[model samples]
Target: MGARVTIVFAALAAIHTLTPTAQAADAFATPAVTINRADWRAAMDQLRSELNAAPEVAADFALTARRRSVAADDPRQRPALVQLNGVTSAIFTGIGRSPVPVLLPFDTTAYLAARRKGAIDPQALPRHQADFQTDLFDAGPSGYDAVFSLPTEATSGLPSRVFARPVEIQITGSVLTYDVADPAGGKGESVKALAAQYPDLRRFIREGYVRYAFTRFGVPYVVSIQCLDSAPRPRRLACREASPIAERFLKALRIAGGQPRRLPPEIAPAAIERPPAPDPDFTYRPAGDIVVNSGARGQSGRADLTAYSQIRYPLDAPAYVHSQSFGRRRASDKFDQPWSQYPWRDNFCEARSFNVGQCASGFGHQGQDIRPGACPVRRDGPEACDPWRQRVLAVRDGVVIRSTRQQAVTVQVNTGTEHIRFRYMHMNPSALDADGLLNGRSLREGQPIGVVSNYLDHPNGTTRHLHFDVQLFTRDGWIWVNPYMTLIAAYERLIGGRGHEIGTEMVSSSVAAPAITGTLPPAAGPQADAVHAPN
Candidate 1:
């Protein structure tokens, strides 16, 4: 009985196997109720009423038909319309760069009724209708090669304003006559004779009238001039005479006692009038004393003398003895030395040459060559003399925007969104632990992060050191700031001059002093001003 039931269930499942669903019959079917004659007639009536109210309906109708025809040919095309968003729509009839027609669709019944009532002439409507339908259905040529419907706001606003307020003198140009009468006839002999001499006079007259009308009467006018003659007998004289006459006419029509105003020059319309200059020294004040520092040579092992002697030296004063006396006899001697071995006893800042004893040479030491003790022969080498492996501290707190372990020699820290990037190069690969801490966690000022080694090669095959560079990005271009400023600034802030002394000792006798004996009184003179070192 169980077997029979199972077989019945399988048979039922098989009968209901997957198949394609049939499409709905109404899909793609045109509804008979669409385009109701009565509704269409009503819509047409309304459209005709609107057209009658619009003064430019004839031009608008011509433009609409042309656009509809183009749209019919290519249904994917957008209709021409003046967008309130201040953007012009696409052209359909190729009349203007913007082909979109701004006219709304006409209601057929109202349009037909208006034509029958003599409100809208059938003769005028048919020409435009035939032109539109021909282009739409038969792809036939149109009477107008190009047509454009002007913005309704631009056309209607002026007329509405004029109707609201009437002006006294209503100065107008010859172009108004052309638009009102036969456009060709308006450019008669007088216009030709005048324009032949002064070509730009007509333009000035036209613009003047437009400005005056718009400003006073709130009416907008367009000027059109036709030149009938090909050449003039006296061109120069005609222009000279016409220009003065046009100018005089404009000057005479100015509203009496209205307002004394200067018309802005067409060329530089946005120029602002400048105000008078303010008095000098109105907010001036004298600057305070400018104290300078000799810097941290005494503590950082950059100076060989006692801390007292180092601090006593005048800022910017020449070193009594060159770096050769401190151990690096030649520039080549310090090449490729580890950071631990960086002449802590000698002033690395004083060494100016890459070779021996030469100051200010082009091949001078590029960076401060520090001897970071000895290099670790093995990964697990003793750490007694070693400063700290990967114990490098950030020079300044900043975001770590980029991190790449593949480039073991350098680590880049982004200080800000500006292109200024701080580069900690020639780093010990092991110094940066799992969490990127140089030593255990934090690195103190002047504390060693890693022993600098010549394990890697430079492009020039010369000895390498920490190549610190400060760059500034400006509108003009990138500029290199002196890194010496950063070094001196950091040194002064960390040591005692501006603030209290760090220890009891005024100066240390030895480079690696375990303890200090006593403290000396602060030195006076310019050295006293060196208290806070400039960072």
Candidate 2:
């Protein structure tokens, strides 16, 4: 540690303000390639058909991060701000004694402000504490700051970070530098074997780490070794210092263990204990005039929703129909069959009892409810409780950013400002476990994310329909965007036609409509938190 430089948050903010703001024009727009939905669907179909035709192969290798410690005497010091490429990052130091570091979108101003005050407001932290950043703490003149945590010296001494959340690297040994003498010779083998063949590489991992750096979305990504339990402090290495260091590090890394099972562990099937079904007398109504909530800006105008944003359907084509439309007040008379509809339209703002002015106070139904056409009846003709039989499809090509098993699955589309989040709820728990749905997995349009089921905490909490919704990235963070028209548009594309009404069809006709309860009561029970829509 010859010289130490600590760049605090305030200085970082000042420097960032002074830096040139001009960025490549293309960065503000999505990719130039136009998406042809038909072609995309055909490609997906072909890929699936080919997969069904291919032979299954067993996984042959296990990839695991080995626990290796770097020597204590390593001299490298962690940089306050390491920005080699487009990405500018800071090391995350875990909260309290937690070994894992908290990685979040960098927000220099907040971090500096927190540091200056020698405390952090817990309420100011990102709402989605795991992976996001917001200006929730910087509401300067507003008296809404009480939502943040009590100020504490949590981030006081750390380097000025892009975010108030700290970034940290796990420590172990010194930064080991290496080079490949011959690329052709070092093909496949463990470091131990490689050390025996190339004696010069023997002391690498045991003593230090091989560092590498790159960038994505104007963000820099750096890889390096950590020197843990070091005498003076932890050490890090820069891959750019020497090309051989990177090449040799790559050659030394190899899969040594045999392949492990790819399937995730299965969870026990959650039991379905149906609550006393509601017998509310709700009137059936078709989609009425679109009421504009003047309080909410993006939703004030009346526009054809079905013709807006490009997105695919969540359910399979043709057969599935909308039981309730966005503004429809129609609901099933039977308490147990909540998803059963009256008007053959889609259901959106049925939670009107929660609050008035649909999209204004964020108190109304935020999304639409869709069902898989008919309920399968058992042999004796009772409602067939086979909720997992139907498939829930991805509405677009996006990343499965958040997959909380049965709770929900949220896919995010990241095409510049067109970025939107699609969430699917009421997935079968067992099916979700079997399919190994997890976070960070990239998904294609039409991929089967999970089976349709009523598994919200319990199997019988609600009806067996996917509660689908859309969210947009706003200054307020990810806020609910009306999905009614989005679904209408997607459904039309799926059927290659307009929304078709069953019209005295078998299911609707057979199940006689319950007597209308002239005016429905205000939504009873507890009003759910607006931050999260009710299941």
Candidate 3:
């Protein structure tokens, strides 16, 4: 018993001795990781507070690696967001003349809305939105301003405003400005030879960008390198300067979901059937020869001098019905009429729609409205209503700037300084979705966008018809241009010898056509804007 008692006392003594050591260790040991975490949290909170306090600083935040909920963003905004998330997150490290770190540079939504507003280049606003923007001033690599190592954004709410200096940098894709080449050199071969001569081009192709340039309308363009690989490294530094930060930004990128349907093949221009009317003379016309002159209503001398015969008819059918034209006219004709009595005609400046100051005498119709076909008396008969038979075709080669599912689709031709726009309204929204006519998609001339319908705010706001109009960018902003002469020229080309009149069978896609190449001009630059395809 004494021995057991002694052992218990000794064990108690040892416990007492070890308790102080354990307590001391606990007291002296600092939680280095926990304290560091607290400090980081405080720093992040302070930084966010500072960013929120300064608009300019916050704008710059678009250049950094940060994210927020875009759940409330519009569906139209999704395509742009997907593009933004893509180009910004691609890692260009090891793809350039110099190796780069991972990066997230381009701000998709901000750039697309401002691309044509003249932020980067003052000469012409970009008519089409692209996935990336280059240094118009060419800030990187001496004499190689084309290197797109930096992501760019125009000042918020001020697209035309130029920055005092280039501030942000990025890892972006490369583009060949072949259109800028001199014509004296055999335009096509010169680009290839120039590419052969450029060392950086070699460097870009080795580790950086996919090689491409805009093919011209058979016109020779100058070749220049723009924005390739990643941002420039700091002098004296052998590797990427912003790599670590860029890596963080890359990880933060959130790619938007869903995919667009593949674009269908284009219709050969030679195969498009024409109306049965005599070919309209395309020679420069006198005002007296204008078919739909607004001057008939005492509004003369307001004609658009720049207007020419350019576009083709928007519909494809045997015959058309016209319940309305441009301007205000009280036509007692019911919405449903047989083709024999109400054949559609070329009516541009005729007296139906809203009033606009840009018209002949400050108060006239805004655009031409033509019905696809006569509606059947029965609401559920075979010929009751068939918008699909009147598929809307693009009149020119351009990018679809707006494809509002419920309202309209606007396509803009991006000529250097003479940008023009065409609008097609009253299309079936479900048909448009099925055809994949989303915003920013490219269209070939004669390409079917969708079927004509009577959709305005909902499915049946007006009778089944297509509203067409043209606009040109002038010093006074976008003004409506008469499409009379333009339609004459296009129709003559479409029909060849003499145009055919509306037949019992719709002219569009009805005539058995052999597969032939289309005559529409191909896009001249890298078509990397839509995320459906790679750059």
Off by over 4 Å in 1: 1-327, 330-367, 371-390, 401-419, 429-451, 458-465, 475-479, 498-535
Each prediction's total of clashing residue pairs, residues at least 3 apart in sequence or on different chains, is 44, 39, 32
RMSD of each: 34.5, 23.8, 28.3
Ten contiguous residues minimizing lDDT sum, candidate 2: 138-147
lDDT per residue (tens digit) for residues 1-535 in model 2: 0111222232111111111112232111111111100112222232233323322300110111222353344211211111100011122221111111111233433343353456756565442122223211100110001001111133332222122211222111101111111122222222453454234332222112222332111111222322211222111122122223223332322111011111112211111111132223312222322222212232332221222246777876323323332322335522224345333343344333323223433334445666664434423244333434666888888656432333667676654213356888777555665676654466899887876666655565565677787654321123344565555545555655444322223333222332221333322111111112234
In model 3, the runs with Cα more than 4 Å from the true position are 1-309, 317-355, 373-388, 416-418, 498-535
- The true-versus-predicted C-alpha distance at residue 27 of model 1, in Å, is 86
Best by TM-score, which number?
A: 2
TM-score of each: 0.23, 0.39, 0.37
TM-score, candidate 1, is 0.23
lDDT of 2 at 47: 28
Overall lDDT per candidate, in order of appearance: 0.22, 0.34, 0.34
Model 1 lDDT tens row, 371-452: 3223334345443333223233345432232122211222122111112323344443333334464211223333344443
Q: Could you tell which candidate, 1 or 2, scores higher by TM-score?
A: 2
Worst 10 residues of 3 by lDDT: 29-38
